[model samples]
Target chain A: MTTAGSPLVGSSGRGRVGRRRARNRERLVSAAAELMAEAGVEGVTVSAITERADLGAGTFYNYFQSRDGIVDAVVAGAVETLGQRLDALTQGMADAAEIYSSSLRHLMRTAVTDPLWGRLVVRLGIAHDQLIATLGPRARRDLLIGVDSGRFQVPDVDIATAITFGALLSAIHAHLGSDQASDPSGVFAESLLRMVGIPAEEATEITQRPLPPLPSLEEARVILGGDAEG
Target chain B: MTTAGSPLVGSSGRGRVGRRRARNRERLVSAAAELMAEAGVEGVTVSAITERADLGAGTFYNYFQSRDGIVDAVVAGAVETLGQRLDALTQGMADAAEIYSSSLRHLMRTAVTDPLWGRLVVRLGIAHDQLIATLGPRARRDLLIGVDSGRFQVPDVDIATAITFGALLSAIHAHLGSDQASDPSGVFAESLLRMVGIPAEEATEITQRPLPPLPSLEEARVILGGDAEG
Candidate 1:
């Protein structure tokens, strides 16, 4: 296991060292997220992260260029996680109300459970122009596909998508910020469906049930187009 | 007429002096808004506002206690003006869709024409939750009356009103923030109507035309009950 003159080699050497490095990086990221959640993004610092991770200052630098880099990483990770969750939740919903209600619930639950991440996402999504530009198109495309297929009654797909999403996020922000007693997600979803012209009775029925399955990939392709399919 | 030793104790004297003070305060607010529009709120300063108003530092303090006070005044003034405009625009709307569309369009036009005020409203609105709490309920009650009278199909009037209003504001923010090619007001109004489950085609038609007159105050009370009417 020990070699003095020879260079460290193969599985026992480079592989083990690489694994250690990856673990260290993972630890740093986790520590950063935890710190941010507890103390807010503004309160987190390099020294605090290092202290939380039980790593030295030099080790922290080895993984991240700066605190901003860590924040970027955290945001990216959170976005990826949210995208995956949404995909899973919306995999096969035929009814527009069902899809909207389910997605709204999922999003609201995520925001409530992980409020710091939610706030960060909303702040980055709305307040930061560049981030919105980068993410808006993809989000719009997903929403339009849902609307175009009669799953939703939205006339102006793009505008409806933006407004609905923004309202949901804002409602979440308000709910989390206040001590008001109500299921914000339920209220948000119910209200949004109502605004889109879904009948009151129908909105209640859809929101009360579990969301239906999304279309198969083939059906999704037909609706979303070949480019979106890929 | 010029008063010598004793001030003229007449209506004209007090009215003239009051008008002068109001004019000076108006000029100061206009100057502050201009500076904020050019530079962001963070960049605006008392000295810059005074300079823009062509007033001395002492005069600036005479009207505003500090930069925060001036900002608050500006925000309050803008909200009041917008609220009045909304009241006028939606005064005669019997149909909820028509009311929502007209009100949304009016708000969007105001936001686009005076982006600085829009930014300030959004910032202050979010930062100070009390602002919306004070304004939102009354506007919501008016819309709810239409719902109760069978003009709209909202199940939960309060939640629907919140989502509709919230969506309208968000849509305007998105349109103004992006390079998207569409009339922000038209698109926002259309989207808002669609969200409530109104068929897109019908939404388009309703939004394009003027709305009918709302019920009288007594009639609204009979329909929505005293709690909602109040």
Candidate 2:
């Protein structure tokens, strides 16, 4: 307890102690993500995580209380920033259909371009508790927007949310499994739009629309409350 | 190393040794099913299975090569009979859409009525390798039927199959999580039918059509190659 001088509770954001704490925490999360990507959610252990992070044994306990705690952090670190990015991208979009389509397309595009992201998503799969916790509300929120706008004929938001989630993960699984050339973002979202009662032509048009570029992960870290980038 | 007089491979189907072998295998499968339903796929260990079956430890290896071998047996034992029953029910049905709808409705109804089945399906989820192995091809076959009949507007059969699998498991998870009164089978199938390009009104009507009684599990066991009912 003599660490009253520790940077964990430093008054200055730029202080040495504050910087060290953030760096250590980031290292732990990155190591956790790497391990999860390689071996899946169930395969990870705290000792493995600390070892991979190059931290001393028991160092993980200072950052995360348990394996589940770090898992939540890993998922939150991935999904929350993406959620924020999507929100910013669609900040002023009036059309709910476009908003929904844009978010899905971007998600698929990210998975396509980022092998690590794709592996993490495919490994976690659809029934992952942390993934669902992080992504479910965002999906439901988007569905409700489409419903409220008179643009969708959804029978039930909850069921639609479930279907959307399942579709995204399963589509990702199939997309990654295949060597065929096709835009998963367009095809996957178009199918979903139609399911929610969007007309065929419109669904196709919306999903195929050009997507805005996603912010770099380093920038997203800042947006997610991490310290400034190098 | 079997006892000299034991009939592990007796020629006569009606012989005492043949009967004992079938009985023992059936007991092991039933015990495995109980453990899986009570816990989950990951929770079932060889020792736990043997303990549950009340058989000597080595008897498990006599029946199943390993835990995975038995897990496959458990999923195949559950899914294959259901697949066979659906085939029989839809054999003469010309309407591809109706055939697809009927199969989904029966699945959901089984989950609703059979809590054990529901728990197992929800626990296994869509990422389950064995569940997908057993159900994936069947799902693709039905989607192909609808596509060939010009009754379904499927963009990609593979993606559609993935969605169907995902939606079914996630919906089941939601259904079991909630205490709602609405018909899950009807709503879930209707939504999927629309996703595959069925008209909303038609999809609703098809999903709401009177569902025929599913063959009982005992009957299913017989259809799946277990012995006749007592």
Candidate 3:
């Protein structure tokens, strides 16, 4: 309802419109995120998102060009933000192998505690470029650090990164599906650490070390710099 | 159409009806598999299956009770059949590590040679239980063999199995996504062998050894001894 130059509409009207637009976009993103958690990335459609948001089909187009647009927005907001937070969370660590092990342990722990988050990422599968783009480089960076310091034996960094990413999803999926009483974070991280050429015993020891907590969203925002919004 | 107690319909009618049912079901499986490969497991639906099968919506129910039913049939058919064939192909191998490596290499090579097969399994994602059920036990069995032989250092068999399954999908996803001219089979197997506790140089050598051909369908049937239908 705001016009650039109108006799009747004033600056306050533009401010109200801007706030409404932001709120509506947030609604769409939330709806998409929830739907993706329930029904993988491919399951999220524009009509479904608009319906979930209680907005008109036309409103969806105004906010997002397509399903992919909204998916990227969701992944960027959630997964990428978490990636940055994990990055910020581990920056003070000195050990290359611990950095990698700690990051993986935290990822599995997060998935175990938050089933919705785990399902969304697991459902995104391997072809999900946004998910990979967020997590891949960070994983690669951690592995390279391990390799450079001679703390881990990573013969192929790209292959190792791909395995780490995939194994995380699979382990989360396995834990979610199974009813066995097991500490997944420790074992999963241990397996991956070994995969990267850490001996089994040392990998186990590294993963067993007290895990530092992830920063709260507010703390992560301040620590990572700038608005966390993608 | 034939009725169980219809004298006039006879055995020929029953035979014709059975053949027709088999043909219709095959159409549905092929349709569902194609849709799954294109749209992922969550994307395949009853209407989509029927439409792609060139059958009426009601006809879909005549064969499969729901989308899950048809999806299971598709996964069991394509994926499980491959698993059995893999079993038949490697039954006589002396080295447990070679058995494991050869199987993984074949899987990667199949995916590389056949993109559709690769996409269908990857799109199935991590949560598809039937996919896991078919592949999990075999991976576990291979790991157990390695463990029992004292050739591989597997601290936890279950976790290693999960990693192997996840890494296969992830590596295939990586190879399909990238244009990298890397031998995914050797590198992937090498990484996994290292992960399971083989030393780097030795793991590299094992993966580099000769790989025998997988059994053809006819050969697999004779070798496996039974109808391969799940």
Candidate 4:
């Protein structure tokens, strides 16, 4: 009989070891993220991550091809998480204020909780050509849906996506880097919503409370077509 | 008597020598910008800049304190130019769309024609904390005036400033880096205008024509507040 977790396990005693290997990879990524937050990107190294995760140097190599490979994995994981959260936040929102507020709050909470991820995004957005190129298309598609439904208004969906993402990342970077008065997340979200033209009174109310309901998936699809489906 | 050009012409026989020093400084900065664009930040060095500018090794030191200093000066000059242009674009505009269109067009032109400066800003925005700190306040004040005047309908001036600046810079970086498109400036400006809540049709029209006239100094003070006489 075949089993779901049998590929690595079927060969001798390798099955049990494969589960451990997967766990170890998760541990290493988590450890690397913690270190990056405390000491910035320069602080992460294979030796340090392995030590933090209580794994051997050999074990680290088994999971990742190189230090950069580990970083790439971590970054990819963070981006995926961010994308999922953003999708959830705007999924049903019909009102522009509600949509903007939910997105701002979601982004702020993510950035505050995982500042290293925020910093990594900002750094990559500016310095790494390949990564930004990959992320740009999906982001543009989302913005276009927002624009088409009147939940957002922009002259060009592509450019607005680039700017909004850039600004959001930069704000998080600044907030994390500073000791300024006020809640960083609140400040970051509030500012971004206003810049994109959500009314001040509406922005204040949304930021303070839970987001209102949005269009159903079908309704959104009717308005935004294939782009909204994504 | 000391005159405006006095610094350009040093006392005694040093006047001719001073001109030579100024010329060398200009050449070094220009060379550094070129090298940075061609090779990325890591590839630039004093030797490389000097060689590219056709100056001797000894000539480089006469002006810059170090390679970092050259980078600082080059960044400062570019930012100063950007600031001046923005100021000029906003000098007399009454409507938000006009201001947005004018400022964005100038910015787009700068990004396309002088891509090196755009890259420098992105790098500095990511790596240099102090530079961002200094520019943040001035940017906030400018944004606030627009908000108060109803030229912009943002909820939070501070957040709006961050988003506006961040979006512009990010879009420019993407445009310069991409090989898939042509003339991204119009699209970029239109995106920004739309984000600020301007109607799409109006944004497109303004972006295609000359920007609205900038406010005179007197009018600017009235709108911005503070010393009307100053």
Note the B-chain TM-score for every model.
0.70, 0.84, 0.87, 0.74
Error of 4 at A173 (Å): 2.4
For B34-123, candidate 3 gives per-residue lDDT tens digits of 898898877788889889989998999888778888788777767776787789888888888899999999888878877777888898
The per-model DockQ list reads 0.29, 0.58, 0.59, 0.34
Return whichever of 2 and 3 wins on TM-score.
2
On TM-score, the leading prediction is 2
Task: Give the alpha carbon lDDT tens digit for every residue of A1-230 in model 3.
Answer: 01000111112545767867877887888788889988877677889989998999889988777888888777766676677668878888899888898899988887777777787788887778878888988999999998899888877888889999899888888877777467689888887888888888898899999999987555776776775533
Candidate numbers sorted by TM-score from highest down: 2, 3, 4, 1
Proportion of native contacts present in model 1: 0.42
> B1-230, model 4: which lDDT tens digit per residue?
01011122223455776767777777777788777656555568999989988998878888887998887666555554354446655755676566656776766666666676666666555435544654565466655666777766655565556666676677777777677357777777665565465556766777778544434333444555563321
Give the DockQ (C-alpha) for candidate 1. 0.29
Q: What does candidate 2's lDDT look like per residue over A1-230, in tens digits?
A: 11111112323557776688777887888888888878787789999999998999889998888999887777766765576667667656898888888888887776776656666766776667778876788889988888888988988889888888877877776677778377678888888889999888888888878877765544444454544221
lDDT-best of 1 and 2: 2
Least lDDT summed over 10 consecutive residues: which range in candidate 3 chain A? A1-10
Q: What is candidate 1's lDDT per residue for B1-230, written digit by digit as tens?
A: 01010111112445766867777787778777667545445668999988988888778888878998776656555554345445554655566667666766766766676666566545443324444654576457656766666665555555555565456556766766667455667766776666555676887787776533433333443454444321
* lDDT digits (tens) for residues B1-230 of candidate 2: 11101122233557776687777776677787778877777788898888887888888988789888887777766765566667667766798888889888888877777766777766666667778876788889999999998989887788889888888877876777679466688888999999889999998888888987766544444454534221
Best by lDDT: 3
